[model samples]
Target: MTDSITISVDAMGGDHAPRAVIHGADLALRERKNIRFIFHGRKEQIDPLLDEFPKLKPASTVRHCEAVIAMDEKPSQALRKGKNVSSMWMAIQAVKDGEADVAISGGNTGALMAMATFCLRPMEGISRPGIAAIWPTLRSDIIVLDMGATIGADARQLVDYAILGSALARSLFDAESPTVGLLNVGTEEVKGLDYIKEAGKILQQASGAGFTYHGFVEGDDIGKGTVDVVVTEGFVGNIALKTAEGTARQVASYLRTALKANWVSMLGAFFASSALNALRRKMDPRTVNGGVFMGLNGIVIKSHGGTDEVGYKSALGLAYEMARSRLIDKIGDTMQRFPVNTAPPELPSDSEAKSA
Candidate 1:
């Protein structure tokens, strides 16, 4: 626990791998001068990149691991074969061993989750983990989760998401008490799946605990900042995140086409160049690159596997911020005040399971 923050990085984890990881670390150093890096990957791959970043050289060190988790590897396969040997696992181990404040990887999401869950384990009372990501919005940004950590979350798990997400919002936004909501088809109590309704009931009763709980918010509310934190099961949350990302790209494509449609439009675009630049900044996916793993003992920031240096840098920046904010301690403190119920959701009857 030095004054300077140490971030453990999975240097061999992305599509563009050690190169992007190294470059991103260098970029992050410019933003935070008091950060150090513990890079885990092949020495041959990382050593050459150090030559390119003289400033980063002194603040960084390498731990070589021969295995690199493949992007498409199954979670089970990764755990069984590469668990302790892979760069991804070693990076997470650094966090568990108190060598780093945070871990960042542009690796297989499923594999990372598997390794992280095993190595770091869940926080004391957290039954399941949720992958939380920042959603850019008109007002500012919102945190959305269970971004595919598990396929579905039960009522209690959903409440855990609200508490966990609120902790994240408080840390990221620096708000003393942040708002939270449950994503549903409608605002009505009668709508949505049974579990979501159950979660809402619990959240409403727990509002004064630490957050302002908005009863129900639809998909459209996500972009309106209706709530600082939006909670949902992993399957739907993942789909929503992908849809939003796709929509942003589609909108950017449309703008590009419209601006070049004619001479008059092109002239209009020239006049609106500054505004367009602002719009581009708003829509850039790289700006919101990392997905924070909630309910874990330590912080792990998951970068998109295919992202470039810009996106990787954003992920590293996010990791640095979470570490600086003491996000894990905040989450633990919040959970202590708002203790999560340990009861598991009721399993469907044998007949019911067979019928579907």
Candidate 2:
């Protein structure tokens, strides 16, 4: 690891491309003085933005790329059309070529995942890569994995997710032995599908693993911070993630409606404005914007496409922290430490597998 870290940016990926991306990088650079950037996008658009932030110019280098991947474009189509020419591909290629420590994009999630996997490749011994998200909880935050990277994980893959999520918790939270849990229908050992139960057994017996397995965690346990890391297959993880996001918004909406219901309520809200602001900050999705692609050879972060500079800055901050902590190396070490003796044989339901 070096004192200075270089990050590759897909400047034209988001809805507010080039401008928001560049501004966000500048914001991140202001906080992390040791960070540098390699911006991949059109010269005409990126040059003007770079000129706006004088401090960012010296710390950044722009690589001209003509193509852009559409948010709605299919992964296969994006890869075929924009492999070498798109800004997203160039950003990821920087990581592969060792020009950057980490790569980030606020683009199409599927496209970014496809390009990253194609360019950087998965880590050694990893059959499928997982996307890990930093999830907010009552106590603080927990790391959740397979947020939509690949679907239908077998017992072995579920165990792999446990390793990946625990590494992330270690890197971000600095937990020496993070408590991990498998997301299931019930906390009982006999609950959940066969693969889930098998994974539970493997995790239960994993002695030298970097994390402590806390048995099965139900969906409610996620928000309560029952464990430091939550592991699940993409099918369930994605649904859980979206449901949480939606529920957050729903709660905020309800609060706003209640606050404005009557003059007395409005007065009460005004009186508690400071506390309300704090609550709003805690609930903001932008505060935890990055979705990290774990089990990959290089670090790649995906930000929300519609997010503003604040959200993008949060993503960049995550990238800086992951790179500074040597997240890939930590994950590699943890993967090696994972016990592989309890892997279950093939199951029938896991036949129709899909990568996200």
Candidate 3:
């Protein structure tokens, strides 16, 4: 933690490109000063932006990369066209090259994941990596994982996600032992898919895994802050994420329509304008903006490509915290403690067979 933590920034990956990304890095430095940036993108596009932030310029290094991955490009196409030359690929490569502690990209989700997996690979003993996100809840923020990194996790993969999510919660919340839950259809004992139930059993039996198992939680419990970490497969996790996002926008739209309905309503809205503004800020998805690809050898945080400076800044802050936490090592050091029942039965070794 003493040494300056280097964060590789994909300066040209987002809709706003070097502008929003550099502005975000500058704003983030206000909150955290120990960060050193290695920005990957066209020097012509990035240098001008860095010059505006004199404080950040001295603390940053820029690496020129001519190619940029388009938002519409498929992961395969992105890799094929850019390889290690794209801004996104080069930024992720910094992590694998040991030049950066972590990489942050406001780029195509599939491409970022693809490049990250190709460059850094997964940590030893990890079959597939999961993406963990910070979710705002009624009581406190919670952590949810496998938000479309890899879909259809088996019992063991689900359990690995729980471990990764728990470590994240601890890093963010400073919780000594965060409570973990399996997201399910219902809270009843016999309510979920076999894999979920099996993962729950494994979590229950894993005393050394360093988290409190809170058992099954329904979708309703997510916003209620029922647990510090919620574990689910990517398919369900991604659906829940989109549903929450859409619900947020729907509620906001409904409120706006109500406020402008009539003279009396408009007057009421005017009087309560301050409170409404605070509510707006709270509900803004930009406040919680990073999806961390966990269970990898190094951290890779995916920022919303369409977000503005505020949202990108949040992502940078998240990357800083994760790098400070050394999350990869923590997850790697603890993963061996929990093994799921769904793991295929092991075959006897030749020596054991002969002895038998």
- TM per prediction: 0.95, 0.95, 0.93
- Model 1: per-residue lDDT, tens digit, 1-356? 67889999999988999998899888889988999999999999899999999999999999999998899999999999888899999999999999999999999999999999999989877779999999988888889998999997788899888889999998999878889999999998899999998888777766867788888999999989888999999999999999988888898999899999999999999999999999898788888899999898899999998888889889999998899989988887777777334434433345754876
lDDT of 3 by residue, 1-356 (tens): 45778999999978898899999999998888899999999999889988899999998999999999999999899989878799999999888888899899999999899888888887776778898889999989999988999979788788778888887887788886889999999998899899888877777777446688999999999999999999999999999999999999999999999999999999999999999999999999999999999877889999999998999899999998898887776676566555432344232335754876
- Residue clash pairs of candidate 1: none
Clash count per candidate? 0, 0, 0
List the global CA lDDT of all models.
Answer: 0.89, 0.91, 0.87
What lDDT score is found at residue 156 in candidate 1? 83
Number of the top lDDT candidate: 2
Query: Taking the tens digit of each residue's C-alpha lDDT, what string does model 2 give over 163-279?
Result: 888889999999999999999998877788998998787788784489998999999999999999999999899999999999999989999999999999999999999999999
For candidate 3, list the clashing residue pairs, or say none: none
Best of the two (1, 3) by lDDT: 1
| Candidate 2 TM-score, true structure as reference | 0.95
